[model samples]
Target: MSFAEPSRIEPDDNQSRGIALAILLLPLTLPLFLFLCLFVFLPVGLFAFLFSFTGELLFYLSMWNDGRTLTRRRLRRRLAAGETGTLIIEYPMLAQGRTHAWWTPDDISTLAPLPIPDRSSDEYQDAVLDLMEQDQSHPWDAWCWQEYTSTSQGKASLLRVWNGKKYQEWLARHYPSIPIVETTSEIVRQLEIEAQQKSHQPQP
Candidate 1:
């Protein structure tokens, strides 16, 4: 949370004109926006997502951006009520389905989820690591660049490689002091136990 005073963008002094303009525009733009979202986007998106990885990224990115919007909205409401303190939000990492705890000040700042490519995809190595869209410096601590795969039982599993290309530069640049701690042995043990328990269960 930034202690700096929030910049106020004063609305038009003539409220009636603004209201009239909105009234005029709503009938024209609302339907068009809805049309694009429903007919054009949804219809095409359903098939595109199944056929192309690029489409999958676009769809998920939109959802992540929407999440950021909600986060910002909640932060604004809190700030408006004279709340000030460190704000920590827990979220799943963009690169993988794992917990990521964000510890930062109680400002309205938001981190948009990164568009990380799937580890098995050809573009994984070429994936851009830029965070310029958020208009803030990279918060390296907020990122978890692990890969995930489905286990035999359809459960999610995390795979963090110490020398994974996607995260090598990110680790060195942001988290120099924090030693790498993510490992798979514990997860492997957990999965093995789960398998054994399943095997012991009576068959239907």
Candidate 2:
């Protein structure tokens, strides 16, 4: 299945913060180094300069690599081959903090799609009420259209489509066979429980 036009996923807030900090520190390194060289110790000054420069260089490289271009390319090829698997795009928070794995076709019978709850559903309404009652913020409270699950070797893997408008459109068009059925966090919790149970079961 073809993916929606690859929209560039930006680095997360933590990464952006790190990049900004690095940029701010980079200029100070030279002045600090110069002061150290003139006053206290040449080695200390050199260390300070090298440390700041290297840190910034590494941060920039990391930001560049986190773009996910390579992963998307690989995922497209795999999808075309009818491989139902999870593509972990690190830059996005779509998966809601779960271990990521891509299962081979031999690993599971099929990928089951879990539909997001509609506004009218009692479950959705209850969740909203709970949110107001608790008055607490949750990142995962955002609406998600569906979740895909696959099981292999007694373990379950959860997958969510990357949150890109174009990408969701592409999935709808290309993978209509994938049914969208209502699901909730309870389903994911159940899968985790089942996997744990399986793991604890003694092997023959």
Query: Local error of candidate 1 at 90, Å?
Result: 21
Flag regions of model 2 displaced more than 4 Å.
1-70, 85-116, 119-126, 135-163, 179-204
lDDT of 1 at 63: 38
* Cα lDDT of model 1 by residue, 29-98, tens digit: 9999999999999989887656655543453454344442223345346546754432222222224433
* Candidate 1 error regions (>4 Å): 1-13, 52-94, 97-204
Query: In model 1, what are the clashing residue pairs, if there are any?
Result: 1-105, 1-106, 1-107
Question: TM-score winner among the candidates?
Answer: 2
lDDT by residue (93-166, candidate 2, tens digit) is: 22233222222233212432234345346666566556646643122222121222212222222232223233
Candidate lDDT (C-alpha), each: 0.38, 0.43
TM-score to native of every candidate shown: 0.23, 0.28
lDDT score at residue 7, model 1, on the 0-100 scale: 100
